[model samples]
Target: MASLLYRLGRLSFRRRRYFALLWVVLLGACAFAAVNAPEAEDEGFTVPGTESQRAFDLLDERFPGGNSEGADARIVFAAPDGRKVTAGDTRAAVERVVDEVGAGSQVREALSPFEDDAVSEDGSTAYSTVTYDAPGEKLTEDTKKALMDAVEDGRDAGMTVEVGGSAVDAGPEFGGVTELIGIGVAALVLFLTFRALVAAGLPLVTALVGLGAGICAIMALGLPTTTITLALMLGLAVGIDYALFIVSRYRAERAEGHPAEEAVGRAVGTAGSAVVFAGATVVIALAGLSVAGVPMLTEMGLAAAGTVVIGVLVALTLLPALLGFFPQAVLPRAHRAARQPTAAAKEAAGANETTGAKETTGAKETTGAKEAAGSRWARFVIRRPLASLLLSVVGLGVVAVPALDLQLSLPGDEAQPTSTTQRRAYDALADGFGPGFNGPLTVAIDAKKADDPKAAVAQATKTLKATDGVVDVSPPLFNKAGDTAMVSAVPSTGPSATATKNLVKTLRAEADRVEADAGASMLVTSQTAMNIDVSNKVTAALVPYLAVVVGLAVLLLMIVFRSVLVPLKAALGFLLSVAAAFGVIVAVFQWGWLADLLGVAQTGPVMSMMPIFLIGVVFGLAMDYEVFLVTRIREAYVHGERPAQAVVTGFRHSARVVVAAAVIMIAVFAGFIGMTDSMIKMMGLGLAAAVFFDAFIVRMTLVPAVLALLGRTAWWLPRWLGKVLPDVDVEGEKLTRRLGADPGPPARTTPREESVNA
Candidate 1:
């Protein structure tokens, strides 16, 4: 691993011009491809063999002409003075807009609210439903342009016009304000951490280059539906952090008196290796989403994983090559000349040669020169390992309490922010009809086996109406063939409410009873039902997915560190941090503790996909800090320092770097908290909180205490296991040997080093 990074570093420096030009041309090619990329299709995710899917299949088979593929668009209109919708003047305005929309292209059917009894009882609000000929996502750009023009006509009239529905509300906008905000935060963090303008800009420049290529590749592949915003979010976070890690190391090496080329090589050989491992862990965890057997999740995970792969490659190759281009700009001027002798300093050195020699000897004997500011704190924690352990546990425990009450469900219209027109349309429909009006369930019945198909339809309708949760049951509509009938039922509860979920289950149970009594096939299907089905499948699959990720991570860590306890400790701490993140999310979003402040609405259950995503992303990120911190500690341990002193020294050196990298990630993720979409906001905040806890509490505090408490046992592994496990040399110890600076033998029985203790 170290040899590969070292070779890459040497190659980058050797052919720096070619490397720079290669990246520039690649970026240009990707940009050109992005401009000419084909439009992506949105084929929504579904869990096969679920009841809702079964219902959809039956409907498609039995009723070929039914409105299954297309979605209805709702045009909401209101008078500026709040005049009654039925007023002659308001009616004329709304009718004109409705006429314009109906006359527009792609309209399969247009039902005026006035003629269709869709007006509110107070007559202040009315809407028109327009059904398109094709699926909402399949609408051509020309059709969208025409629709927007018709919408403009309504707005031009003396009315407040808003449109909502699948055709009009194409999810959330991606990579505009949110993307910029994230980049701004990342740039700020980098500048503050590096304290050099040019040094800070390097990571951002490389990261953006990598991000552009990643996004362009995604666009070119035309799998935009699976991962649009998410891919961008991760690409930015990982790319910046990956470069930051390598740059920090490179600067550190330069500060320690290494030449520019040598520093870059060692940095690449060491930190670059860690980046490779960390990035691979992330990619593996993300790609593990395939275990869920959902196409959308699979594609999204793979897409995001692809970006991380690019980030790793960019960090290893492009970053080194770029650094080589302006080696003087990689660090501060003061740092670059720290080891050089000036004229006056050289004369003073000659006069005080004996004094200078003694001072140098004292500095070599003392550890204070090498100790970081955080080392004192780390040493203090080591002294009171038990107390530190208890405190860290209690702190993480408090944050994890809310996770016990974690509920899994996909947010429906209720989850949409109130600012959106789709949400307003949802609220209008709920206000006029009922909450359930926005989430009607379709009951499909195959009654060809029944003695009397018409009678079976009547019986099922009666049964549904009699159900406790059913607020209204539409009259059964049969296919032209008379073999299939469908009924639409409005529940008494809103879609995301607990009562609505119960209602779904209740109706399914009753439908079974009806099917048994009438000898007909019956299935319940709806947008809400499909979401519930997906939520349930995701929830069920989460455990296995986690098991796979955790198992693989543990195995990988064990091999890398050659320690059984170390990996277990890391895995456990990571899980705790992840739980705390979820707990914070549940308290903030689900419990509505600070939903107003955070701009989160539609709070009921956390998004079903959130836990799955959090596990993969958060776990991978936690492993990043784990690898960074633990590998340093292991390096010290292999060099024969006592466990406690080794931890203090390792923590002292790696603490700031780990914390800085984590802050960059937190900034990148937290910047998206301002997003309008509740799901994206959740993801942003959840990831930020998870990284924070993992870096600050788990890595900084708990890990050191545990290692101190365990002593040498922390590095223990069975002889058989150690021999079988492949040596994943992340520390570049082999490179040290080749550099002729290898420390001979482990100080197995040497007295405790006084320098390490202080």
Candidate 2:
């Protein structure tokens, strides 16, 4: 693999123009395709094979022109203090607003509060329901304007009015501010790491180019905006990091006296191999989302995987080609001067053996000093392996304690900020009508098989009303054919409350008894029920998903490191980091710990898909850090360095770049927290926290400690297993041997030196 990559890198560097032009053409074509692609439609949250979904399908079948795919608005009206909404002018104002709303474009109908009995018991507040002919995202600006105008009129009439529901929902706000901030921070980190503008800018340039192409292709495929946003986030992050790794390697090779082309080849052969392996882990984890059987999550995973693949390709091909164009500029100033010595100066310096030897000694001393400083943290962990391991494990375990109380639910209007009209309306309805009034379950009764449909419908309604958690059951409304009856049941608890989830389960359980007695089929469903079903489905899939991801991690790392314990250690470390991340998410988002500091407007259950999604993403990234750091250690050990010395050498070569990459990843993920959408915010914060735990705590601290304790056993594999496992030369061992490069000095460590230096 290294030999093949080495040849490819040299070919790309020699024919840099052709590769550069090819990428440009592809980017342009993708952009054109994106511009011509049809608008992407949202598939909304739909979980098949669930009772709630079945009920929805039944509704679509029985009522062709119903509001199943359409939008709805609830205009909540609150009277002034000492006033009743049903009194005189207040009543007249409510009726006027409902009439105006009904007259708006795309509005199918708007029921008056008085006619629907939507007035509060005290008559202090009321609400009207407006149904639209299209989905919320498809509603015209004119229609939204008309609704707002009517709301303004009601307010002018001495009433406080707010519109909530799907019709009034504006969807997620994404203005690119967060992405820009992330990119900016990444640029700063790169510049600081490289200390050369040209070198730092190269990674950013390559990343942006690859990201643009990936995003444009995703757009061209007509994926939803949310998917594109995710692709952009993952693509930019991995692209920059991959390029950074390769570029940093190329500079290190050049600093070691390799010429431009050879340095590029070695860098691509070595760092590029690690990049490919790391990228595969991410792709596997993300694409594995298909096993969850959720269409939206599947799309998200696949899209992100594709973007990461593109990032890898760009790093392997485009980045090396770019490096070939500015070899000297990419190196540090000191290295550049040493690399470009004039023939006369070289001849004069070489004429005196003692002078040349002194110059060489000085250079080695300077390099040694840098290595010592870089490996300082590794040395600390190595010296106190047991204590370091214990500290990391205990600290992470403490953080993970909060995850035990994690609760997940789909975010609803109640989860929105108080500043949003949806939240205001939700609060008003809960205050005036009831908490359950905000989310009423619709029971679909199929009575066509019953001898008497009306009697069957009546029996089902009675059964629902008798349910413990049901607050009220509405009169059954039949379809035009009179074969299907729909009953609305309001629960006593809020939409996301635990009791509401229980209510859904109880209703489904009671359906069997109702069917036996009335010979009718009942499907309990609603937005609330669907949310419950989705959360349940995600939770059920978590273990299976974790199993698949962990298995993949073990298998992949075994191949990369060629060791059983190393792979096992990597997988366990990944789990620890993920647990810690989940703990932080639960504490902040669910328990409301430091919620105000993080700008959380309200706290409830964590988003249903957060845990599984976090596991998949963080697992991939954790493997990335693990592979990059450990592959170097394995490389040093393979080259005949003692296990202790190899640990120091690996950290000396890879720690700075790994830390920079991790910081870049954290910056990108953290940017998402700035988004106003609660789900996106949660995703951002979770990923950021996960990267922090994995990179700094697990990969940096725990990994070295564990490796030090294992010593030579860290790289061991059974002879039988070694023969069975395919040899993937991720460290460029074959390339180094083929080029006849010196494999560095041999290790001669005493027991005391091993204990102290390791």
Candidate 3:
């Protein structure tokens, strides 16, 4: 693998223009395709095989346009204190608003509060319902604006009015601010890590180019908007980090006296191998989302995986080609200055051996000082391996304690920001009508098997009204065929409440008894019930998903590291970090711990898909840090360094790059917290927290401690297993040996280093 990569890298560097032009043409073609592609569709949250899904399908079949699938809005109006909305002026104002809303484009009908008996008992508050001809995603901007404009009449008449529902919801307000912030932070981190403007800029450039191409391809495919957003986030992050690794390795090789082309080749051969493997791990974890059987999640995972693949390709091919264009500028100032004498001597001596020896010696001394400084933290951790391991484990365990109380539910209007009209409308409706008013469950009764359909429908309605947590059950209304009946049942709690979930379960359980007694089938479904079903489905898939992802991690890591314990340790550490992240999310989003500080509108349950999604994403990134760091250690070990010395040697060489990459990922994920959508915000926070825990705590601290304690056993693999496992050569061992560039003897340790390592 390394030999092939080495040859490919040299070819790219030598033919820089051809490779550069090829990438440009590919990107341009993708952009052109994107422009001509169909618009992206909104994500659908249907959970097939669930009762709610069956009910929805039944509605679409029997009721057709009468179902709740079409876009609809509830415009809530509140009069001033001591004033009644039924009064002449208030009633006139409400009627005027209803009329204006009815006049909007694509509006099927708008019912007045009085006509629907939607006025509160006190008559101080009322709400009108407006049904649109199309679903929310199909609603034109003009129609939405018209709906908003219609409410101005009621507001002008001294009545507080807010519109809530899918018709008025313009999916999360993403103005590109978050992406800009992420890119800015990533660029800054790269500059700090490289300390060379040209080198820092190169990664950003390649990342943006690759990301653009990937996004264009996704757009051309017309995926969901959410999928594109997720892909962008993952793509930008991995792209920059992959390029950073290759670029940093190129500089390291140059510092060791390799010429420009050879340095590029070695860098691509070594670091590029790690990049490919790391990328594969990520792709495996993400693509594994398919096993969950959720269409939206599957699309998100596959799209993001494609983006990562593009990032890997760019790093291996485009980046090395770009590096060829600026050989000296890509190196740090100190390295460039150090190399000037060597360049001059090469010119003066015409490849003389004496000058080359002096150049190599000077470079070695500079590299030695840097390694000693970088290895300090590694030494500190391994010095008291047991203590370090215990501290890290205990801290993460404490954080993970909160996960025990984690609750999962889909976010609704209540989870929206307080400033949003939907939230205000939701609060007003709850105050006037009931908390359940916003989440009424629709009962679909199939009475074709019954002796008398009307009697069966009536019996089913009575059964629902008798159910616990049932606040109100509407009169059953039969369809044209009279074989299907629809009834609305309002629960006594909010949509995300535990009681609501229990109610859904209870009603589904009661359906069998109803079928037996009345010979009619009942399915309780609504937007809220569908949300609960999706949540339960995703939650049920969590354990199996974790099993698959963890198993994959073990198998892949075993192949890369050629060790059983190392792979097991990596998988366990990943679970620990994910649990810690879930704990933090529950504390902040569920328990309301520091909720206001993080701009949480209301605390209730964590997003249903958060845990599984976080596990998949964080697992991939954890493997990235693990592979990049541990592979270097394994390299040193294979090169004949003692286990303890190899730990120090690898840490000194790879710690800085790993840390920088982790920080860049953290920054990108954290930027999503600023988004208006609660789901997106939760996703951002969970991913960011997971990365922090995994990178700084698990990989940086726990890994080294465990490795030190295990000593030579850290790299152990049974001979039988070794023969079975194909060698991945992630450390470029074959290439190094073939090149005959002897690593030389381990540097003699200083007294301070010896004491730390003792």
Residue lDDT tens for model 3, 115-199: 9989999998899999988889899999998988888877989999999988978664443577578778888988877778898
* Candidate 2 off by > 4 Å: 338-369, 741-758
**Candidate 1: stretches off by over 4 Å:** 77-94, 114-126, 134-162, 176-179, 338-370, 741-758
lDDT, candidate 2, at 377? 78
- TM-score order, best first, reads 3, 2, 1
Q: Global lDDT of each model? A: 0.78, 0.84, 0.85
Candidates in order, TM-scores: namely 0.89, 0.93, 0.93
Q: Give all candidate RMSDs, comma-separated.
A: 6.7, 6.9, 6.6
Worst 10 residues of 1 by lDDT: 353-362
List candidate 3 stretches off by more than 4 Å: 172-179, 338-373, 741-758
What are the per-residue Cα lDDT tens digits for candidate 2 across 1-758? 78788778887887888999999999999999999999887767778878889999899899887736788899999999999998998999999999999998999889998999899999988999998888898999999999999999999998889989888887655435876788899999988888788999999999999999998998999987777667777888899999999888887665555566777788889988999999999998998887777788888899999999999999999998887677667766554455254444333322211011111111221233323444767888899999999999999999999999988888988878889888899999999989999889999999999999999999999998888988899889899999999999999999988998888998899899989999999998988888888788888898898788789778988999899999999989998999999999999998999888877889999988887888888888899999899988888788777777677667767888888999999998888888778888898899999999999999989999999999999888999999998998998777788687653323232243234223
Whole-structure CA lDDT of model 1: 0.78
Clashes of 2: 0
- Evaluated at residue 518, the lDDT of candidate 2 is 95
